[model samples]
Structures are given as C-alpha cells and as structure tokens.
Target: MRTFLSVIFLAAFSLFSFAQQPYAPAAALPAKNLAMFGRGLYPGNDTTYHLLKRSGFNTILLSSFYIHADGDLYSGDSHQPIIHQGKWVGDAGYVKRVKDLKTKSSISRIEILLEGRWYGQPPNTFDFIRDWYDPAKAVPGIVTGTGKESTLYNIIKVLKEVLGADAICIDDESVYHSPSIIAMGKIAADLNMHMTLCPFKRNNYWTEILEASDNNLVDALYLQCYDGGVRNEIKDWVQGLKPAQPIYPIFMVRGSFSTCDTHKGSKSVAEISKQLRGFKKDYPGMSGAAIWQMEDLNSFVKLGCAIKQPSSGTAKSVAEFLSQLKKALKKEL
Candidate 1:
C-alpha cells in the first residue's frame, strides 16, 4: 500500500486555441488506457500522443484530481493548458494535434485520476492537499456539494465544447468518510461519462465503492500490480475484482538503465507473454493490459533479461506486448 505514481515534468509544448472543439463523451472503451503524468496528457511532446496512437494503447490516463476548499474540482494534473514565457500553451500542441487522431484509434478514451486525502464529513467535503505542494497542479473536476450542485452537470454540459474529455478516474487516496463518491457515481452515470477506479489493498474498500456506485457506472478498474509489496499477482487479485467489474492490470514499466529494479514485474517481453499465458490458463478468460506513466516508455520498451531476440525494446515491443494482451483478453473466461 506504500506506492504512488511519479509527478509530471515540465515539457516543452505549444498551444493551439481551436475554439474549444466539441467534447462528446463517447461510450467507455475497454479498460486498457495508458496512465500518464503532467504537463499532464503526455505533457511530454507531440510525439507522445502520435506514438501512443501508433503503439496500440487505447486510453490515456492523465493523473491527479483534487477537491478545492472552494468546492471546485481541480485537476492535480492532466492535459491542463498553462502559460509559459507569458504565452498560453497546451501539451505543446500535443492535445491540439492528437485531437484528430482520437477517432482514428481506440485511444479516444481520455480520463483523469483523482487522489489524496480529505477531512471532515458534515458539509460532505474533502481536502485538496495535493495543490498545497504546488498550485500549478490544480486541474479541474466537476464541483459538487457546495452552493452549486450542477458543477458536474456543468462540466458535462460543456465537456465536448471545451477540453473534449470523455471520462473520470477515481484515485481517491484520502479514503475520507463521505457519501461524495457514491453520489458522484450517480452523476457520472447520468452524464454518460465513463468512470474508472484505481483501488489498492482493501477489498472492503472495493466492495464499498462498488456498493456506492450504480451498476455499470464503473466501466473499468486499473489495478496497480507494482511498487507496493502486496500480493499483486493477477491470479490472486482478479478473484475479488473481476466479479465486480472488468479489471486490467497496470504494471510498472522498468527503466532501461536501471539495475536494482525492485518490483514483482519488469518481466521482459517473453516473460510478460509467459505471465499472460499463465493468467489465461488460470482464468480461461479476461483481457487488457496497461502501464504506469508513458514518459518512461523508452525504458519500458527496452526489454528486460528474458529477451530471446535482439532489439528487445522497441516500439515493436509495445505493439507485441499489446497484441498478446489483447489476445488474452479476447479469451472467454
């Protein structure tokens, strides 16, 4: 339970104000999105998005959503536009450029993950402490509970009109005692915003979360199987989670130059394939795979020890990994 994602770095980006194109929240895609960090939305470069659409990844997970004291749901991160050198910019033209690619690839599933803790219960409120560390981290979520209940309604109202986002990821690390989540689930369902969750350790928490949300509201679950010293084995985790909803394992991709890597996975292409084979053999069903933070993709693509061929890590590695993953997912469990 003692693991979290890394923050986003300031990447060079350009902005394109396209009169804020229409934001249409499409039907939720199957749970296989790539989890990313700041400038958010690959905030890395235009190539990031282009490569992803090429890499066969279906969804993009921009991290961190916080609840402001003002009841405004701010994105702790995500593909939020910012000012650099006194100029308004957006993912260095990544968002603007990738906008056209969405319909072409399954990568159309764009979501933001919300995390951190909250205090109190009465006002039905929580704290957005992640913003305290850095104000630039405040990305927006639909505001609720305050004087205005339509905050979510409003975001949905203009989703396609402004950011063109399609879904929300509940990364509520706070575990605050409140009805907000269950309530939010209802809102997501009504708005047709595909909702996802990242729950770790507590099975009861999973139970409670599912209990709170409406049936089918949580379209997918991305389980973190690395960093934390838990029984992260997919065979072990799926027993409880799969029954609730479709679950995808998001493994931590190892860096290329690292020697002292200390997590359960970091399995080479063949090793990962073997693991998927084992999962398939056991479950006889289930599918999809995801990785944390697309920034380390070069490292992620660099295959680990169990390589059987040269050029172990390449864009090919991603394509191969995803192909095997999709195969396993296609199996009927």
Candidate 2:
C-alpha cells in the first residue's frame, strides 16, 4: 500500500513539473508573398470570392475577431458567434467559402486576426486574454492545466481545426501584457500554428514579446504604414526589432472607410506603387507587401475611381488594383 501511494505521488509531481515548463521555441516560417485582409469576406457573395481567388495574393488574413466577456468569439460587429463557450458556433456556409477559396486560389496561408483597441469603448479581445491567461495555469495544448481549458485556447484550436487557419495575427493596439501574449504564443506553437505581429507602433512592446518567444514563434511582422502608422519607416522598424523574420509593409488603398479617395491613410494606386518602390529600395531584402483590406478595394470601384477596365468591365477594378500591386512589387518601378 505504501509503495502504491508513493508511485501515485511521483506521477502527480511529474505532471506538475511538466505543466510548469516554459514553451520551447521553434523555427520561424517564411514571410508571405502577397497578402490581403478579408475584412468583408463574411456574408459575401460568389462574385467577391471569385475576385479573391484570382487576386494574385498568396495569403488571406480574415480580420477583426473579438471575444466577449462571456467568452463568445465574434467577427467584426456581427452579432453571431463564431465560437460560443469554446465550441464552433460559426456559419457553415462561411467556412465552406473559406475552404473553397483556399482550394481554388493561390492562397497558401489563412491567418485569423485578433484586434484590440481603446476607443473608450468596453473591454476588447486582448483584454479578455489578459484577464483569463494565468501563467501558472498555462500548459501546452491545454492552456489552463485544468481539463476545462481556456476560452483563448479553445478559440485558437477551433480556428485551426474548423477554418484551417495557419497563423494568428496579433493586432493588440491597447492591451500589451507580455505574459498573456507569450502564453498565447506557446499555445499557438503547440497547435502547429505560427504567430504574426501587426504593429503600427509600440516597438518595445513587440520586441519584448519577440525576445520572450525566442524570435522563432513569430514568423513575420506586418507593419502598418498607413493611418496612425503614417509616420512609420521600414528602416526604423528594421533597426528596432532586429527581427529574424521578414517585415512586410501594409498599405491602405484608396476608398477606405467609405471615402472615395484621400482618407487619412488611404493612398491612390499610383501613390501605393511609389511607396512600395521606395520601401524596396530602403530594404533591398524586402520579400513582399500587403494590402489593408478587400472592402476598400470594392469601395474604390463603387466610388467610380478611373481604373482601366477590361472588355467586360465587370470586377475589373479589384483585378486592376491587384495587378498594379503585383507589378509594383515584382518590377523595379
């Protein structure tokens, strides 16, 4: 009886020690070739999906995920839950469309974007991560050591399993807790998913997380070069992070946020091309670039921007924009 009790104690102690171990860093993956954010992909029609499949973008980032106080996951301002109480509660049609896009298109990667901000509104998604993530309870795969698991962990797993997401794009504009992010990164790495940082500012905050993750879990940095990050320079960010991963500059196209042109950060096609040329010149090793979103591309077309249309002129605006972007990145223009 004493021998049996001793064996059980040893097993429990081993489990405890294993749970307390820090996450092992893995090698980073290559940066995306050409990426676009699908901010308006949900509730989209066949036409939009068709455009995306032929858009020449190799990566698609589904944007703007929010986590409620009740641990329900929402996309953008949609009332429907993508994950309710750590289960897949999202639309079946939406998942099918995403899968179909990947199957038919040049899209090699799909990343779920988690954005948090302080617009003087209620608590955001990262805030929930900060509140719920306890380091002592965090373990690989099962984040909460307890069998119940954490809402964040469940959400990550569901995204990977259901939507076939390859990475989690961190767009934490307000909440900057390192422990929570690092813990989240560990969980992501364990699940065979990479983490990408979308930072407009806060270099130090990002640097800390990168250092803690051993600069491997984070494969790329999508630097916002528009809006609040208008003043951001690639050289400055490169010098700051000293990153092993590639840094892609994200540009906001014309007609963002319902504006026809010349929004705070929105740039015309010509302007974007010029900027990309300059960025490539500054960082000779620049692998690729990304567009801010798809909604803006549609907006530019609807707002009657003078885009050179094909013979049909049907869906030519989006195609034209993408063509120009690809040319800008490829050629030395």
Quote the RMSD, in angstroms, for model 1.
14.7
For model 1, the run of ten residues with the poorest summed lDDT:
5-14
User: Which lDDT tens digits does candidate 1 get at residues 1-333?
Assistant: 223222221121212333343223465565443433322344445555555666555677665444445434443345232322212333435457545547567566676565553333322223433222222343354333411244444433333334456666776544543355655555555565767777666666666767666546676777766555234666666676555566666655444334214345554444445555665576544556565655444444554422433333323454554454444334422
On lDDT, the candidate that comes out on top is: 2
> What TM-score fits each model?
0.64, 0.83
Q: Candidate 2 deviates by what RMSD?
A: 6.9
Tens digits of per-residue lDDT, candidate 2, 1-333, equal 999999999999999999877544332343537888888887577788777888777888998788777777788836578888678888788888887887767777888998885344658888778877874654334344212266677888899889888889999888888778888887788787789999999999999989988455688889999988998889899989999878999989776877665676777766777788888888887887888888888877786665432221223467776777666655632
lDDT value, residue 1 of candidate 1: 25
Highest-TM-score candidate: 2
Cα-based lDDT at residue 213, candidate 2: 80
TM-score of 2: 0.83
Residue 125, candidate 1: Cα error in Å is 11
Q: Per-model C-alpha lDDT, please?
A: 0.50, 0.77
Deviating ranges (above 4 Å) for candidate 2: 1-32, 118-120, 135-148, 307-316
